[model samples]
Target chain A: MSTEPPALSADRRREVRRQALSVGAATGAYGISFGALSVASGLSVWQTQALSLLLFSGGSQFAVVGVLGAGGSGVAAVLTSTLLGVRNGLYALQTSRFLGVTGVRRLAAAQITIDESTAVGVAQPERPAQRIGFWLTGIAVFIGWNVMTLVGALVGNAIGDPRTYGLDAAAAAAFAALLWPRLRSGDAAATAVLAVFVALVTSPLLPPGVPVILAALAAVVVGLRRGGRHEAPPTSRAGELPGADPVP
Target chain B: MTTWTTVLLACAAAYALKLAGYLVPATWVEGERRSRVIALLPVALLAGLVTVQTVVGDGGSLVLDARAAALAVAVGLLLLRANFLVVVAGAALTAGLLRAVGWG
Candidate 1:
């Protein structure tokens, strides 16, 4: 990676900012559902808002609420969320090469280094736009997510019964949509099926969050037996080319 | 521990992992097999989550209820290539309607 960034044209810069902001806005809008769900799942409004502000990663935040909502222990909630958050670390691996920062800037980058930011960052041909895409998207998402989370949390607090509105089903559907795009290859699909089966079989036998954690072993089994052909890391596939597809 | 404790701890762990990626050398984690497993981990976890969320109920009982019907609707929408919000809303409406009609 070159330290000297190629000069970006005004039109190119404008295009990159537009892409980043739109991605951020769409993702942040989705945070409303998370806020409502977290409250319905037994977290206080402050707690839910705190999650959006600090945890920031959509999948990990969802996992925490999901696990806790199912009556799992705090340890299980933390473990499941942490497992989902691991991909952000991997995304950071790619973004670090393009985003060479230090001290306060480096800390800020690490905080916002999520799927959306990394995806938008790497999609750019030039380094300058890449930096803009990453920062603007990250900051936009952070603000939008927190604000929307507060609104949803207030609404959720007012709702009498979450089941009446089918929030539980909405949560399930959210996870399904998130998992749907990842099931392209046969090995990945097989692993998903196996994981689902394991979770179902163990749901009654084990605790709530424990089954999901145990189900992760399917990846190890499948990955070892079947080699991955896709050269680009899986995170790149999660990029939102248009605003329609929202990636967590 | 309290909910606040869990929330704080979880956020810390998640941020720490993200920071670790930026701080650590690429050589430490760059391996084909390792990355493949890491990549597939979320797929497995999310699938498991969908199953649990759809079918499993309080006390970890397997209860095929309106949630199952909602999940079916969600799968159908996904097949139709509906966006994320549409799929979620459709599933919620399905479940809510089914429950309203005196069905599980």
Candidate 2:
């Protein structure tokens, strides 16, 4: 048996860089909306900038600002943000295998494993491509998001009513953009539907962030069941052929 | 809570969640069951988020207002497989039209 490891050649590295740049452009442009809305939600420029730099997850930042704007308690805001951000943990697990780095590099890899980076990395066909994709997208998003936040905050401050300019919808639009492609698959579509159903049905019964968590759990159950079904005998081979060959 | 306290707590919680995944030990992470569940986690989580934002937002009052209309337009755009920018613009335009029409 051959023991040679799968290696990404120089051309593949260039392709990874290109993919990263594309994802970065999309993610960075989306950040403009977050920055504008964070400021419009009554957060100071410094506070908005801090969120972009430290929090770094667009979903969490939007949730926090949305809660705050709605007059929710600070605790509620934090909890909401935390709940939305929980997805990054999942991304971390998926991306870590591609990193192959140890010690400080591993730590750095973990730090940058957000949605954009994870998506770009996971989309690549080769291991080296995955690593390069992840880092480039992560760094690009980080720099681009922070810079756009500053710009949006300043503009939001000057404009006084982002609603009039339609800037407030930026986050939602950005999120929708991210979510749309994922819905293409049957399993993903089922999970999405289940999650929405759970959240909607349970929202009134639970506390601020509790419903979201419960909805996620409900989706997990559905996903697990779906996965279990796929693992059953006949479908096992089915999974290996055409469907599993596609990138997530 | 003070702004600093809130920020600190938020950052701490976010980091804690991130760290929890890493600390779960490679054995646990490597299991087929764990991998299957983790694969579905993001979809479920994001779906929950979208549902909450679109449906029950603010004071637990369900309003089919401008936001909802815009979201509907967005869904349509998404169905068409429109580019991201076009989809966003479509939603914004829907919202603006609703507002102009005194709907919300």
Candidate 3:
């Protein structure tokens, strides 16, 4: 196996940054909705801003606020939100392989392995592109999201009722933006349906974040059933599905 | 619950989970099965989130509120392959209209 880092041109790095910037812009806009809702859900501006800066995961932030709005316990809200954010682990693992990072670089890489970073990294044409894409997207999303959160919080405060202006819809709309392009296959569709079903069934019974965790479990089950014939594969290159490009 | 306390605890828990990814060894995460499962994780998590938000929003009630209409419009736009900004704007517009019509 080739352990050496692939050569990357300056143009490639720039391209990666451009891609990251677009994704970041979209994600950042979405964070505005989260900030608005978080405050509207009874969190102080300081609390909402802190969560945006500290947690930095949009889905988990929504889950936390959803639980809070429902009057659930703090422990329950935290637990649920934490569970939903667990996918970052998978992103970190995939990104670590491409970045070939260690020590401080490795730690930083892991910190930035969010959805946009992982997607951009995985979508790159080469390993070097992957590393650049990951870092660029991660940093971009972090910076853009925080700034947008501040904007949203200020607007939400000014507007009073966020629902009156349909601000809450932005989160779902942003997620839809992220999700639509990825649904390219039947298996993905099935997994999505199963997840939605699981969430729908469990939401009423569970606290805010737990339903997402359960949906993830359902997807895992589906994946295990479908891909059970072989051991899991290493990170596939962008534009290549599993079993599409076999390494010699 | 003390709002600040809730926020603090939630933030701490979230950071802990994010940090946990680095703590777990890579060896445990390797394999085709594991990769497939990981690939599906985001969709599953998001689906659950959407489901929860749509079905049992505030007050534990499942009403055909503005949020639902906005989500439906967003989903339609997504299916139609609209640009991300366009999709968001479409959903927001639908929601605003619904609210303006007193359906929200």
Candidate 4:
């Protein structure tokens, strides 16, 4: 692929921005659920907002809140969140070459390089649009997500019992949604199934957070055992929004 | 540690990992064998989370409750390719209704 950015027609430029904004809006809107779920799990509204502003990755944010809600240790929550955030790192590796960001811009670029922005950035046909798609989607999501998170946290705080609104179940559904797309292959599916069993079996004996970590370790073993087999790397599917549900 | 400390530490770790990608050499994450493992890490952890959330109850004892039913609803919605909000709403509605009706 040529590194040179083809000159975009004005229409193309507008089109890319439109796509970026729309993707940002859609993904950011989901932050409401995150906020509600976070507070229900016992975080203060400000803490929930902090996760949105600082952690920023949708999947990682949910993982942290979910673990803590389940009575997991803080160590467990951090480890789980870190594991989920690894994908964002991989995404950065892919985007950094084209992004060519530096100093403060580099830091800013790193902050917003989650699944949605990376997906939108890579989906564009032209180089300039890629950058535009990345930045616009990142900024838009940043603003929209934080605002919606505050709204959701406030509502959730006001609502009293989370179970009254099934927020617990909502958290489960979020995990299921994130897991669904990753189950594209037999090996991935097998890993998930086994991981679930491991988690369940160990839950009664181990601490809240340890079971998930053990399950992740199991997946590493599986991955290595099956490593040489031909399979599409998960990053190739980066075109799909990381946390976005599949369109019906 | 306090939840506040945990939150900050986790956020810091997440940011560090993201920044590492930009600063570290590409060769570190290169190679199919290693990358494939990296890819499946979330799959495993997420599946574990879903299991724990859906079935494990107080003291981590396995219990089939409204959450299980709600998860079933979530699966059905997912099969129909419902968007994220719809799936979550469907699960929450299902669980809430079940709880209202005195079911687990």
The top-ranked prediction according to DockQ is 1
Q: Calculate model 2's interface RMSD in Å.
A: 3.5
* Model 4 lDDT per residue over B1-104, tens place: 78999999988998998898899999998887688789889899999999999999989899999999999999999999898889988999999999999998
Would you give the TM-score of chain B in model 3? 0.70
Candidate 1 residue runs with Cα over 4 Å from true position: A1-4, A226-247
* Pairs in clash, predicted candidate 2: none
**Candidate 4 CA-lDDT value:** 0.86
Report the Cα interface RMSD of each model, rounded to 1 decimal: 0.9, 3.5, 3.8, 0.9
lDDT of 1 by residue, B24-85 (tens): 99887777778778888989999989999989988899999999999999999999989777
Output the lDDT of residue A238, model 2.
24
Question: Model-by-model lDDT, in order?
Answer: 0.86, 0.67, 0.69, 0.86
- Per-residue lDDT of A19 in model 1: 90
List each candidate's DockQ score: 0.84, 0.48, 0.52, 0.83
Ranking by lDDT: 4, 1, 3, 2
For candidate 1, give the docking quality class from DockQ.
Answer: high
Candidate 1 lDDT over A66-176, as tens digits, reads 888888889989998999888889888888998988889988999898888887888888889999999998999888888888988899889868888888788888888
For lDDT, candidate 2 versus 4, the one ahead is 4
Candidate number with the higher TM-score (3 or 4) = 4
Model 3: CAPRI class? medium
